[model samples]
Target chain A: MRRIMVCVKRVVDYNVRIRVKPDGTGVVLDGVKMSVNPFDEIALEEALRIKERGEADEVVAVSIGPDDAQQQLRTALAMGADRAILVKTTDVVEPLAAAQVFLTLVQKEQPQLVILGKQAIDDDAAQTGQMLAALWDRPQATFASKVELAGAAALVTREVDAGLETIEVDLPAVVTTDLRLNEPRYVKLPDIMKAKKKPLDVVELASTGVSAGETLKSVLVEPPKPRSKGVMVKDVAGLVDALKKKGLL
Target chain B: MATVLIVGEHDGSKLNPSTARCVTCAAQISGAEVHVALFGADLAAVAPQAAALKGVTKVLSVANPANAHPLAAVLAPQVVALAGPYTHVLGPSTTFGKDLMPRVAALLGVPQVSDAMSVDGPYKFKRPTYAGNAIVTVEAPESRKLVATVRTASFEAAPQGGQAAVEAVAVSVPLPTHTRFVSVSAANSDRPDLQTAAKVVSGGRALGSKENFQLIYSLADRMGAAVGASRAAVDAGYASNELQVGQTGKIIAPELYVAIGISGAIQHLTGIKDARTIVAINKDAEAPIFEIADYGLVGDLFQILPELEKSLA
Candidate 1:
């Protein structure tokens, strides 16, 4: 079957104001709103669109996180994925190990394309997609704003610091979604109900034979230093004068 | 002694300033020897610039026809081949390094430290997460090679006084053919690049339309500054993708940053957090951008921008 595998991550909702704990351990996550990582949602949306456009036959949503990550996978299904897979794990997975897990699944699933977010909002690592492509020994098009399937190759327009860079990659490649890709569609209530019946499989991290390596030890997490209080300028003239005094004009 | 290999970025001619920033980060390691690697079809014009960085001890130039365009798949193998003598492999956190470094890490079978804002120790680093709202201190394994991307905004560019030897290294790794560079559509602007500009003027959705964004450009041009835009402005099509300045876009630390008609979303604030002087011009007096701004002006940007331009003139 012509299939596209989309990887979604459950993270703190984008709108929430994340606060670090007073103990310098980590951010407070108790009762914080959790949703699909915004970039991953765009990835899933692109996968579903390709399926809808008949460029592919099925869209499979996959996620590697706690068991609660199933919630995000269900949201993916509601957004029009054919099925979902949850690689259950309680510990936080680093990017390299996460890439290994995806590589393992890719061997079994054998999908034509693997799509994922460029970076998770929580860690902002932005490494998994490229690492996966390297482990899989396939082409990677990261920070993709546009993807078009043409025959056995896909044309991807990437958002880079230089500008809009367009590249073409053969099939069985990996693509990472960027912010400008597409606005994800909202899931309807009826689709949510229907998604419950969809085949959502759960696999243990141990069974995948990929150990989540803690190559990096977390020393501590702290809030960023607060900026000094600012002065309010009355008009452009005052602002210009203030800047000139600072030798910034 | 810590041996560091810095992957130099360039456009086939001149070395990017971001590479010099990486050199500054690499030089922070105690008892360190820093080397830079440049890859392109021809490095005749760029190799000297890489060797001139003050802390750089050597420059390895890998010239090949296939490396003219930096496809990560083609470059990762070559980087891995040259990975033998280095304790750390570092690149800039810009888009080029973000795309290429992880692949090198994976190929080397080691985890990568992305966007290292501070070098705590040889294996320890601090990076920003949650869109720069939080900082995390992480220490990689000393047993393995450390691969990291240096946050360019967090460090100054390395001075150009060194006379390191430039060597031509022949890496005979098989390059991948699955990926091909089609073309790049870049804005042919005479203004300075947004990432490295000393001064920047940015607009937001409040500009209303792309035409009104010219006010930002006019003011920037007057000040010899680069033009940037909030993600909202880019989403509204008031600016191009490359002009975006925020967490999801370019993180800049220009000496002076002017945010006109920007509501100062946290994501946008993250990008300019390191800027030396911040000036916010917004109609809303309570915009969060004013909280961090050194100077805040609450007024209509339409009238203020013109007056600001004239006053500068």
Candidate 2:
């Protein structure tokens, strides 16, 4: 393989318990901690591993977001991506638009493989990779837990609802990473310094020949209803008695 | 009338219950004439089951040798070919639908509403984001065909009373051969499926090891409940990947959910928020699982497991 393009997105850190605004507009993002989407980090780690194993020559990290997303791309470079590309935009890029941008880049880079997260934590809309594959007219293996390249095809083990399902797709396919894929390696301090010197090219979203087609509009935003506090039972006998009382036994 | 075409999910033998739940969601749309599309090598047993769903009016059965497996690349084109007559295209928000619907949306040049939990109107839906921490009402354009994946957990399965007509349709789209199905290794169990189970028993990292995790299976079997695990237990190799119940794993809604030796993380809670009744048993009294549990017990699970099973017996 010549090159592998990995897609990364900036999202609220996983540990943060997000709170919706009182006005019911959107989540508060004033001073929250942000990092690379966990699934995307795993995808980048897989790409780097493929490159390190001599299967691919270069790994390019790409993202579409505001300028702050550069911080996440730099982290990708620090984690060993050969270079990074940031498609600059201030507007919200929905999954369809994001797929279009990736499609353009895929045609330009002609990478043998493209990897991305199954879903971004913020939107939880797991659509980009499959949509991109449709636009690119290529094969898509999503929710991949294990990927092995053999000859001109890749065997991917996906984490499906029933169990593990393995499929084979020809080269130049798109794979979306699942949680069990791999634990991402941490970016060390020296690698951070080296990453600062890596070539990161920034381009406008409009220049990619893709429009931010925002079709769905958010009419209202609200927090989830909290569960009511419960009672503590003294013993297993009491638990059984209580469950029977509630008709749950 | 708004024509809503639902993609039916099946495993060659029978239709998945998720398809019925999608039918329920589609019924919420005003004046929706629901039809199910089943793509498989043979629809002998599954087509009748799809037509039996309460609100389904017709079953579009596309039988082909290449439709043996649910490949997104192969199914998306066929779905687009059949989508011209319908106004809305819907599928369950399971792995099968999640993998295929977006590709259909892109091919149709329309945006998709993923995990639509509520149908506010024909083009408006309410969906959860941030792992169920936030809910947003989204409105799609009425000019284009609307494609969506229904959140099965949020809707009840439609009753089996309808006598919908079944139509065997042949699609003439060119299927791709670049993606091939190799094999699937599914966990064979007599226990009910965790996704559609009425009762669920979930273990956590506190279960200690693979051997100790058997306590959970024993309790679940005794209670006739499905078995699930927290991500920690799966990561520690105490449980298999498919048994994990969390935001990244399976989002399920059951009548009763019992959490034993599990400290509830928000991620895990996201999966069970819709469960009707929750019971928690943990040694630590401060475990977050107790907050949402309708009944909480603080004790050693080893001691409680045997007692609970004996009481059930």
Candidate 3:
């Protein structure tokens, strides 16, 4: 049976307004609620599709975040993952260390394929999946728009600046899901109830012998400031004349 | 002793403009030697282009039949092997570099830094995180080799004067058998590439229709600029997905960027933060694009663009 692991992240809900602080460290999400990132939901859908097609025997969802991330894991389970693994940490971890935790999990789980959102909504770095693939010394296909599973390998097509490029890599490789991948499915009432019974494994970050505090120098949080509003022009001709006078045209 | 290796991005015949930008960035760090490494079927054609950059001291060319195709799988191992002696590896933050740099970093068991706007200390660097909203300074643990994908627009392209000597390097690793370029159909546009273009003109949902985007293209054409679009414009079916620029879309840093009718969402700003001079034309004085813009015009882009086109004409 082919084993597949999908990584998910908990982030500020899309509906909430994000405010930047003065210091430029982080954002203010006071009244705003948090939820699973939208892109990760897409990743989960892709994995579920493979499992539904009998392309894989099992689908496992994993997250490296605070205990609150269990909510996202539960949602993944509700969507059809067979199990969940939460690499729990009290403090926020940096991308480098978070990648190490994922690598450790991969070492233990030995899944034939690994999948993750192209980027988390919070950091939006888009580094972990590619970093994890590098650390494991395995080939990776990132920003995949389409994925085709083969007997012992998979053919992945990625979006590039010049054009699309396709590559076939052996199994047990990593593939990061992009926004163009698929529209995520919503959990039904019955599946949400079934998710409560799904197996949930919580592992502490300390158990991996990786220091979250040490990995990151410090936490910098600030709200993003609003941009100044400019005047709107009524027509193209007048705006052009205005620009030409200003030498901007 | 910390040498920097730049992976050449162009087809073996010419030095990509981004490579010159990468060279300028590497030169900013003191005591770092910048060398350009070329891999492909033709080294003779690519060497002079590498040798022309101002700060580049050496040009290393690795020629093999396997490199005829530009897949990351074929290029990553060769880069890893070539990067053995250097402490830093730099590439332009384009689609190809974005795909290959991490693999090289992973091969070296180190973290790959993405979209670095500026570097402060020698090894410790400052890079944007959370989609350009915040910047972080990171210290690599004892690892000598650091891999970074440099944002092309963030740095000035290096001057061309230095006499860089070219030498051939050998590659023994076999290429992957599964991947090959079947065919490519690139959209032929008169405008410049959004990433490297010095000027860009973008539209948003306020444009009302795809036909109106011609105003953007006309103005861009007059100025020899590239065309871009907000996510809203793309979703509204006014522009192709390839032209979209935002947090989840393509990041662009042209010398001059013109935003037309865009409401200035945070996601869109993240992509254009690096543009040296931003000009915003929106009806809403409250539109966010005006905040970061170097110049602002409060008017309808529909009227502004055609007038501007006539003025340029």
Candidate 4:
């Protein structure tokens, strides 16, 4: 039986307007709400697709954050993961350290294939999957738009600048899902109820011997001034002339 | 002292124009000894170009058959292994760089800073967040080394002066087992590379249809600028996904950026935050783009674009 692990992150829903606090330490999510990151939901979909096809025997969803992140795990479970693991940490973990926690979880889970969103919505540093592959000394692929099971290995199509490139790698590899990978499914009310009863194992980051103190040394965040209004041009010719006059053409 | 490893992007025999810009960024961060690593089958043909870039003290050429087609998975580990001695690794924020560097940083147990515009200290770097709407400075403390992908347009490609000595390093790395490139289909366009272009012309959903995007193309061609589009335009099928520029799409920072019929959303603004000058042309005077535009024009883009094209002609 093949074991697949999908990493999920709880983030401020993409639709919300996230404001960075003046302290630059955390974002102020006042009226805005949070949810599982969109890309990670795509990752979860890919994992479920593999399982639905019988390519894998079991699918597990994992997340590293505070207890509130369990919501994301439940979201993944509702999407069809067999179970979930929540590596509880205080606040957000730096990208590298988060990768370390992922490495530890991978060691414990021993899944044949690991998948993650290309990057997190909040940090936007798509490094965890790559770092996990490196630390485990496993072959890895990033930004995969498609993945197919080929014998004991996986054939993946990755999106690049020029076009798509297909690669075949052995199993027990790390793959990061991109936006083009697959459309994630919406959790039906029935599945949402089932997810609440699904088994969720919570582990503390300190238990893994990884210190968060040395995680984020230098951190800065600032909010951009809101855009006011835009001006419309009359037509193409006029727009061109206007831009030229402004030295922007 | 921590050494810095800078990856050089080249087409077999020639280094990319942005390679120098990455080298300059490496030089800015203290405790860094810059080493340029060139990978491909045609290292000898590419060596001279890598040697010509200033601030590159040493060049390591990895020639192998597996490297003929560059992929992030194949290149990430090699970068991590070569980064053994360096405290920081730097690469240009091109598609290849952006795809590979973060993976490399993750492999080496270091935090990877993506699209950083400035570096304040050894591990502290400032990068645009929220698509360029705001800036965030971050520090990676756990790992001894730091990896940063520099926005090419934000830094000037350093002048070529001193010729560095090139060393032929045999490709000792194991062959990539998981993935291999089957083929690549390149799109031929008259526009410059969007990430490095000095000027960019973008359109939005207000253009209404795919045919209308021709106005953006014409203006871009007239100005010799790259073409871009808002997410709404791309989703509306007015332009290709490759042309989309927003929070969820490609980020660009050019000398000048022109937005026609785009109501600057925060997501769209994040992508163009580094552009030195911004000009917005839209029909709605109260559109969000005007607040950030250095010069704002209130008119219909359909009429303004053609006029701008004629003036340039």
Candidate 5:
């Protein structure tokens, strides 16, 4: 492969407990730390490894969001991406519009391989990669646990509902990562410094001619109702009693 | 009034329970004419089950040899072609449905409402974000067809009583060939599926190795519970990815969840928050798993596991 692209997203760190805003506008994100999505990190790590293995000439990291999302793209560069592109969008760019933007990039960049996280931890839509592949009429392998590149095809092992399924997609395919694909390498301070000088092109999302469809829109936001106060049983005996009393035993 | 198309998830022979759950989600739409679509090598044994779902108006079958496998590329266009006049198209939010429904939505040039948790009307809906921490209510435009994947966990299965009409439809959409099915190594199990199971017993990295995981299976077998594991255990090579119950893995809401030696990361807790009653057994007294647990036993799991098993037996 000559060039490979990795799609990343900036989202709430996996550790923080997300709370809803009192106004029901959205989640409280005033001060929450945002990082490269964990699954996206794995996807970028895979692309970097593919480049390091001399399988690709360069690895490009792409993200479509607000300007702050450029920070996530820079993190990808620190992790060894050759370059980055930020499709800056202030609007809540839904998956379809995001896919259209990526499609524009695909036509411009012409990367042989495109890899992305199976789903973003934020919206959890998990649709962009699949939608992109379909719009491009390219083969797609979603929830891939393992991906191995050969001469003209990629052997992808996917985590499906039934179990692990392995499929072979021809070159120029979209691969969405599942967890356990690989342990993303930690970026050192020196790499971060090096990434400061790397090329990161910011493109206006509106300039791409992609219109957000009328398919879906958010109207309200709320936190999941917390479970009732639960008792800590002294032993298994108490557990059984609790279950029996609830008619669940 | 909207005609909602419910895509049936099946392995050719039996319909996945999530399909019925998707029907339940569709039933929430006011004046919904729900239609269930079955596409496989043979729907002889599965069509009737779809027809029996309450609120369904019809069960459409597309029996094509190519559909022996649920390849998204092959199935997406077929669903799109049959989705004519449908104001809404829905599938269960499972591995199969997640893989299939989005492509169908895209092929129709419509933005898909994924993981929809509740329905207010034909276009307005609620869905979870940030891993179920926040539920966002959204509205799709009324001019075009809306497509969604129902969060099967949020609704119970539709009651089975309606005698929906069964019709075999002929589709001629040219299927994609670039994506081909090779072989699938399914984690064959006789116990109830982890997603649909009433009770689940999950182990953690403390299980040590793949062999020690047998204890989890033994206990789950005795309890007639499905087996699940933490991402750490799966990453440590102690279990398959299918059994990993976490934010990145399967999101399940079993009635009785027994977590053993799990440190209860927030990501892992996201998978089981909907569980009715949770029991945690761990050596660490302050493992986060205990925070939401209905019952906690702070002790050595090595000793407690055997004792608990013997008591249950």
Candidate 6:
């Protein structure tokens, strides 16, 4: 039986306007609503669909972060993952370090497939899956929009800058989800109740015995430079007149 | 002295302008010796272009039959083999670089900094996150090797003038057969590339259908501009994600940007905020794009587009 692992992350909701902290430390998170990363939700949806299609036997959802991150794991559980694991850590894990943590999980679970969001919205690093694939020495298909399973391989279509590119990778590989993959199914109260009963194991980051050892560090953060405000013209003729005056014509 | 090695991206015959931009980014790091590695079966045509970049110290052309197509698996080991003396390895934060650099970073046992907007120090970088709303300054351990991808939009392309030396390098890494190049379905057009275009014309969901997008193309063609679309337009299948201009899509900053029938969402705004002159044509008087537009013409796009086209003509 083929088992798959899906990784999810908790991030600030996409709708709110993000603000920098008073100090040059990080973005303001107090009272800001947090939800599962949309790309991760799409990843979980893909895993569930794969399981439903009988291509996989079970789906495991995992997350590595602070205790609040458990809600993200539970959301994955509610979405029908067989079990959930939260690798608790007090410190922030950089992309490579985060990949190391996932590497530890893969060693224990040994799932045939590992899926992750192409990028976490919070950092927008988009390197964990690729790093994990490289560390594991397994094939990877990043930014996958369409995924199909064959006997010993999976064909994935990627959303690249040029166009959709399709590639086939052997089984036991890593796949990352993109936006156009599928619309995630909505969760219901009944599913939430069932998710509560599902097995959610908590493991300490130290127990994993993986250390990224401070590769990239965040020294300070500030808001991006603001664009100067512009004048609103009345009509197309007025716009053309303004452009011509600005020598942009 | 710290040395930076740039993994060059090229289409078989011509070198990509992104490579020159990488050189410009490397130039920002004071006193760093910038070397470009051009790997392809035929580098004779492209090596000279890389060599002429102003900041580059030398071009390492590794002419190999296996490097005809940039399979990350095949290129990662080669880059790692060549990264012996360099303190940092860099690539452009494009599809090619994003696909190739992380593997090189992993092989070299280092974490790569993605989408670096500015260099604060030899080891510190500022990058945008949460759809470019906030910029974060990331520092790296000065002791270890560093790898990063330069955000092309933030820096200008290195001017071509200085004649850097091109040296032939040997490939030492073993090639893998697991990944192969499949068919490419690129949208071939003669219009300017969206990222580098001086002028851009974009449409939104209000443009209605995929067929209606021809109006955008016609207008862009007349101005020798590139065509872009909002995420709403791409999501509705009116345009491909490649042409989508938003936070999650291509962030651009053309000199002249015209938005048609688009109500600007924050995500969309994030992509075009850097654009020099913004002209918005939306029916909604309260559309957020107006707040930033140098010229906001509120009217129905269906009626306004033909008039605008004629005015350009």
List lDDT for all candidates, in order. 0.95, 0.95, 0.78, 0.78, 0.88, 0.87
Each model's Cα RMSD: 0.7, 0.8, 3.2, 3.1, 1.6, 1.5
Per-residue CA lDDT of model 5 for B1-313, tens digit only, reads: 8899989999877889999898888888888888999999889999999998888989999999989888898899999998988889998889898988888888998888988877887788888788888988999888888889988877888888989999998789888777778899987789989999999999999989999998999989989999999989988999888898877788888899999989999778889998988989888888988888988888887787888788787
List each candidate's DockQ score: 0.92, 0.90, 0.40, 0.48, 0.76, 0.76
Off by over 4 Å in 2: none
**Candidate 6 positional error at B246, Å:** 2.1
Q: Model 1 misses residue B250 by how many Å? A: 0.5
Look at candidate 5 and tell me the lDDT of residue B246. 72
Candidate 3 lDDT, tens digit per residue, B205-269?
Answer: 99999998888888888898899999888767788767888777788877778998998887889
lDDT digits (tens) for residues A1-249 of candidate 3: 678889888888765556666675556756668788887888889988998898988999999888888998999999999999999987867666777888898898898889988777776667778778777767677878788898888888776666466777877788887677777887899999999999999988889987765443424444334345434445555556555666655
In model 2, what lDDT does residue B89 have? 99
lDDT per residue (tens digit) for residues B142-223 in model 4 = 3567778987766778778748888877646765656666665556676797767889999998999999889888878878
TM-score of each: 0.99, 0.99, 0.89, 0.89, 0.97, 0.97
User: For model 4, how does the per-residue alpha-carbon lDDT over A123-242 read when each residue is reduced to its tens digit?
Assistant: 676667777777777767777878998878888887655546677778889898877788899889999999889899998888987776445554667775454443544445555566
Candidate 3 positional error at B281, Å: 3.7
Give the per-residue lDDT of model 2 (tens digit) for B1-313: 6999999999999899999999999999999999999999999999999999999999999999999999999999999999999999999999999999999999998999999999999999999999999999999999999999999999999999999999999999899999999999999999999999999999999999999999999999988899999999998999998999988888899999999899999999999999999999999999999988989999999899999999999
To one decimal, what is the Cα RMSD in angstroms of model 4 from the true structure? Answer: 3.1
Candidate 2's displacement at residue B62, Å, is 0.5
- Chain B TM-score against the true chain B, each candidate: 0.99, 0.99, 0.92, 0.92, 0.97, 0.96
Q: After superposition, how far is residue A115 of candidate 1 from its true place, in Å?
A: 0.7
For candidate 6, the lDDT comes to 0.87
